[model samples]
Target: MNILLTGGTGYIGSHTAVVLAEAGHRPVLLDNLSNSSADVVDRLAQITGTRFPFIEGDIRDTALLRRVLADEGIGAVVHFAGLKAVGESVEQPLRYYDNNVGGTISLLQAMDETGVGTLVFSSSATVYGQPAYLPLDEVHPTGATNPYGRTKLHIEEMLAELAASGTNWRIACLRYFNPVGAHASGLIGEDPNGIPNNLMPYIARVAGGRLPFLNVFGDDYPTPDGTGVRDYIHVMDLAEGHRAALDFLAGSAGAGWHAFNLGTGCGYSVLDMVRAFEQASGRPVPYRIAPRRPGDVAACYAKADKAADQLAWRALRSLDDMCASTWHFQQRTAR
Candidate 1:
């Protein structure tokens, strides 16, 4: 299948591209390089030993999307282009809506115009804000507490509505948990532009001496270690989840929208992640306890049985592997 990956140069998108290529699928990458580096294309070639066709453009360009979908013979689209930071979204809600929600609208318009209906949207666990229960399921109640999550929820709702409008759309809304780790080759990883908003990258920087120490957000959460707990899926496993989703969409018996939780189905606390990173890097990830950040849930993970049963997919990597791969990539990029 010829797949068009929006934001394909970004961290997870790049990893998914390698998986698609190895699975004998052509992945046409479309990225604006706003939050990612152009060098990722070269790194992807180094990892896959094949150069993918890449377009340096945004998803908002409906004309560009239409042209790419037509010219590349795109069978489906894996949408990943968006603003993703929670805190930044709170500070810049308009930007988040414009990029994430608006971009999806534009992409959907292009797809409708071009007769391309299959889509695998990159949703987030944040859509299920403040978990109504442990191990969030696809049926879990969703209400975003921040603009970033709201943007994802809005897009999911939009897709649901689109599917109900009598269109032959096969859509998969994969709500991803915390995605960590890097490719085993250490060629590509989560390389944020500014101060890392995610935990793994911050821990990696602290272990690599780029940062002073990690601020353990609120050691008062009602978890085993009192810090927040989250389901941290390895990037490789997350990439495989995308493959499974695409396969599911391809084999769909009817036009419908499906939602799945892509996660390891286990929660790890912030302290556990720090210890794992420290063990992996053979260095201490110094930290200081700080007040809890607003909108942080005590624990958040996935009940991934739906995906396992439906898509025949489950996360297969360990926490140690996640830390080790991330540290390896951190070291490689630091050189």
Candidate 2:
């Protein structure tokens, strides 16, 4: 299967590309490199022992997307292009709407024009605002609290409407939980341009001595350590989940806008991640407890049975693996 992956140079996309290549599917990356580095292509080739093609452009360019679809003979698309910072989105909602929501519409239009229907969209766990239950399921209510989450929820609604309007569409909205870690080879990983937003990366940075201390956001949450807890899935497992989604879509047994939660169905607190990072890197990570950021839930994981039963996919990596792989990549890339 020839797959066109938008934002394929980004963290999750790059890992997914490796998995796709390993699964014997050809993936042509389409990225503007807005939040990622072009050097990832080289790293990918090194890791996979295969050189895949890439297009340096945005998904909003319908003309370019159409041309690429026709020229590359694309059979499916994995949409991963979007701005994803929650705090940043609060500051720039219009940019989030224009890039995330607007880009999806343009991509769908191009796919419709080119007669390509198979799609695996990168959704988020944020759509479930504050979890109504302990472990969030697919049927949970979606009330986005932030602009970034709203963009995700809006695209999901659009996909549902589009699926209702056709039978040829096979779409999967993969709502990812906390995605941490990196490729074991240590060649690529999550590289935030400015200050990191997520806990794992910030912890990694602090342990690596790049940052002073990890800010434990409100160690007063109802969790075991009185800190916030979340479902932290390894990037490798998440990458394989994409492979399973693509395989499921290619099988064509299910139809319409199907959704799956890509998580481990277990929650780990901020202190747990900090300790994991310290153990992984052989360093002591200092921290200070700050007030919980607005809009942050106390605890949120996933009910991953759906993805396991439906897509035949489940996370296999442990928390230690996540931290070790992430630390390896951070150290190697920093060198």
Candidate 3:
């Protein structure tokens, strides 16, 4: 099957492209290059030995999306194009809504018009907001406290309504936890355009000596380590989850919508990540206690039973592997 990946050059999207190609499917990439680089196309070819179709455009361009869908013979879409910073969303909610929400609306319209409805949405665990219980599951109540999570929630709601409307829409919303690590090849990895918003990347930069020291955010959260804790899944494992989701949608008997949490069912504190990276890189990752980031929760993890039972997918990489792979990429891409 030919699959179109919006924001395909981005971190997770690029990794998923590698997995899908290995699964005997063609991946057509579409990105605006806002948060990613076009050089990823070269790295992808080096990894996959296949120069996949790369389209430069915005997901909000309904006309462009329609043309690409028709011309590329796209059978499914993995939507990953959107602003995805929690802190930035807190400051600029309008931009998040307009880009994340508005772009999805346009993409859906084009897909509907073109008779393509198999969609695998890139949702986030942030949609669950502050967890009422540990190890959040699919049935957990969702009330996003930030604009980024709200955009994902709003998109999921729209997908649910569309699926219930009796159209042939087969959708899978994969709510991801923290996705870290790089490809084992150390060729293609999470190369953000600007200062990293995610913790793992920031920690990796500090370990790589690009950054002076890591800001240990809020060493006073109500956690074991007195800092924010999160479930960090390897990017490779998360990419496999995307492939599994696509396969689930294909083998399903009918059109419907479902959500699955893509995580390792484990939580690690900020201090834990810093220490782990230091161990992996054999570098002294100096840090200082900093103020808590806005829109951050004390602790959040996953109860990934649903995904395992339904899609036969589970995160197999360990934290050591995550940190080791990230350090490898940092070393290889050091400037």
Candidate 4:
């Protein structure tokens, strides 16, 4: 299968590109380098021992997408391009809507024009706003608390409508839990441009002495340790999920859309992550407790049964793997 991956140079997409190549599929990467680096292409080639084609552009450019789709002989697409900061989304909702939602619309239109019907979309656990229950499943009610999540929900609705239109499209909406980790090789990993928005990276930075201290957000949540708990799926496992989704789409003629929650099915608190990272990096992650972020959930993990049964995929990496791999990437990049 020739898979075209939007945002392919980004964290998860880059890992998935390696997974796809290892699984005997060709991956053509499309990225603008707005949030990622083209240097990832070389790193991927070194890791996978194969150089896949990459187009440098945005997903909203329908003309470029269509041309790439035709020229690359793309059989499927994995859409990973979007703005994903919850706080930033609140500040600039239109940018999130325009980039995330608008990008999907343009990509779909281009797919329609180019006769490409298979798509795998990157959805987020943020769609399950407050998380009514302990472990969120695909059937969990969606009420996005922020604009970034709203764009994900809206695009999911669009995909549902498109699937219902009888257009021969097969779509999979993969709702990812907290993705935190790097490639095992420590070559390519999560490299946020500025202050990190997520926990693992912040801990890594502080441990590496780049940042002074970790601000442990809200040590008084309802969880056991009074800290927010989340399911942290390794980027490698998450990447394999994409390969399974593409395999399912290529082999099945299943009509309407289907969604799977990709996670570890185990919840780990922020304190747990900090401790694990400290052990992995052999550096004390100094920290101070702070007030809870407004929209922070007390606890949120995933059931993950649907993905295992439907996609025949299960997360094989453990929390130790997650922390150790992340530390490797962090230390290497911090150099």
Candidate 5:
């Protein structure tokens, strides 16, 4: 399979490109480097021992997408190109909608024009909003608490409508939980452009002396340690989940859409993560308690049964593994 990965240079996408190549599939990478680096292409070649064809372009460019799809002989697409900061989305909602939602629309149009139907969309667990219950499942009530989540929810709705239109579109909407950690080689990992919006990177920076201290947001939540709990899946595990989704879509004879929650089915609080990182890096991660950010829930995790039953995919990395791998990448990049 010749798989075209949008945002293939980004953190999770880069890892998935390696996994896809290892699975005997040719991966064509398309990324504008908006939130990633061009150096990732070289690092990917180093890790995989195979140079993937990389196009420096955006997903919203329908003409480019069509040309690439045709030129690369793309059989499927794993869409991961979008703005993904929850706080930034609140400040600039239009950018999130325009880039995330608009890009998908353009990509879908290009796919339709080129007669490519299989798509693996990068959805997020934020679509579950406040989590009406513990351990969110595929059947959980869908809603968005923030603009970033809204963009993902809107894309899911669009994919649903597309599937119902009688086209033979095999769409897999993989709702990912908080993705942390890095590849074992530490050659390719997350490198957010500005101040990190996610927790693990911030903690890594703190441990590496790049940051003063972590602002432990609201250590008064209802969790055991009075902090928010979230299902943090390893990036490698998340990459493998994409592989499972692609395999399932290939084997199934259907023109419908399916949603799967890619998570470890376990929740860890902020304090727990800090402690784990300290243990992993052998350094102190200083922190100060602060008021809870808006739209933050006490706890959010996944059931992960549907993905296991259908795609035969389940997150296999531990929290310690997540912390260790992230520290490895952080230390190497800091040098």
Candidate 6:
């Protein structure tokens, strides 16, 4: 299957491309380099030993998407294009909506035009907001707390509505908790353009001496370590989750809008990650306690049974595995 991965050069999309290639499928990568680099294609060639089709464009370009879908013979789409920083999204809600929601709308339109309906959307556990429950399930009521999350929520709603309208749109929304780690080869990994928004990469940088120290936000949270705890799934595991979603959509039984939680069902605190990363990288990750950001939760995790049962997917990597792989990539790039 020639899968069209919008934002395919980005962190998650690039990882998913490798997983798809490992599964003996061709992955067509499309990105405008808004938040990622074209160098990922070269890295992917090194990882997979096969050069994939790389399209340098945005998903908002409906005509380009239509042509890509038709010309590339894209049987399915794994949409990952969007501005994903919560703080940035709070400052620029319109850009978030236009790029995340509007780009998806255009992509769907192109898919409709090209007669391609299978899709795997990159949803987030942030849609569950503050988590009324401990382990978030697919049935959790969605009320995103921020613009970045709201964009994901709005897209999920749109996909559900499209599926409900009898469009035969086979879609699976994988609500990822926190995607960390990198490929074992260290050829491709999460290296954001500027300051890292997520925790693991921040810790990696701090350990690597690129960043001075990590800001341990609010060491008074209600957790074992009194720090914010989150379900951190490995990037490879998250990538496999996308492949599982594609497999589900390809089946005759998968015909409607389905959603699953892609997580490890285990929450790790900020300090836990720091310690683990320090151990993995053999570097001290100095940190300072900072005030907790508003709207931050004490802990957030996922049930993950739905994806395990329905999609035949599970997060197999351990926290050590996550830290080790990330450090490997950091070492590879730092040189």
- RMSD (Å) of each candidate, 1 decimal: 1.1, 1.2, 0.9, 1.3, 1.1, 1.2
Predicted structure 6: clash tally: 0
Candidate 2 backbone collisions, by pair: none
- Largest TM-score belongs to which candidate? 3
Per-residue lDDT, model 1, residue 52, is: 95
lDDT over C-alpha atoms for residue 201 of model 6: 87
Off by over 4 Å in 2: none
Off by over 4 Å in 5: none
lDDT tens readout by residue for model 3, 1-335:
99999999999999999999999999999999998888889889999999999999999999999999999999999999999999999999999999999999999999999999899999999999889998999999998988999999999999999999876899999999999999999887887887888888888888877889888879888999799999999999999999999988988443699999999999999889988888999998999999988888999999999999988999999999999998888888633
Candidate 1 lDDT (Cα, 0 to 1) = 0.92
Give the C-alpha lDDT of model 6.
0.91
- Which lDDT tens digits does candidate 4 get at residues 1-335? 89999999998999999999999999999998887888899899999999989899999999999999999999899999988887789889999999999999999999999889999999999889998886898888998888988899999999999999975899999999999899978988888667888888889889888999988779888889999899999999999999888777766444569898999999999999988988888999999998877566788899999889878999999988998998899877633
Query: Among all windows of ten consecutive residues in candidate 6, which has the lowest summed lDDT?
Result: 291-300
Per-residue alpha-carbon lDDT of model 5 for 1-335, expressed as tens digits? 99999999998999999999999999999999988888999999999999999999989999999999999999999999999988789889999999999999999999999999999999999999988898899889999899999999999999999988866799999999999999999888777877788999999999999899999889888899999999999999999999999999888454689899999989999999999999999999999999887767789999999999998888999999999999999988632
User: Candidate 3: what lDDT?
Assistant: 0.93
Tens digits of lDDT, candidate 6, 1-335: 89999999999999999999999999999999977888899999998899999999988999999999999999999999888887778888999999999999999999998899899999999899988888889888888788999999999999999998775699999899999999999988889888888898899999989999999889998799899999999999999999989988888878989889999999999999998898998999999999987557789999999899988889999999999999999999633
Could you tell me every candidate's TM-score relative to the true structure? 0.98, 0.97, 0.98, 0.97, 0.98, 0.97
Q: What local lDDT does model 2 show for residue 279?
A: 88
* TM-score of candidate 1 versus the correct structure, residues matched by position: 0.98
lDDT of 2 at 35: 76
Q: How many steric clashes between backbone atoms does each model show?
A: 0, 0, 0, 0, 0, 0
Candidate 1: worst 10 consecutive residues by lDDT? 249-258
Residue-level lDDT of model 1, residues 131-202, one tens digit each, is: 878879998899988899999999999999998886679999999999999999999999888888999999
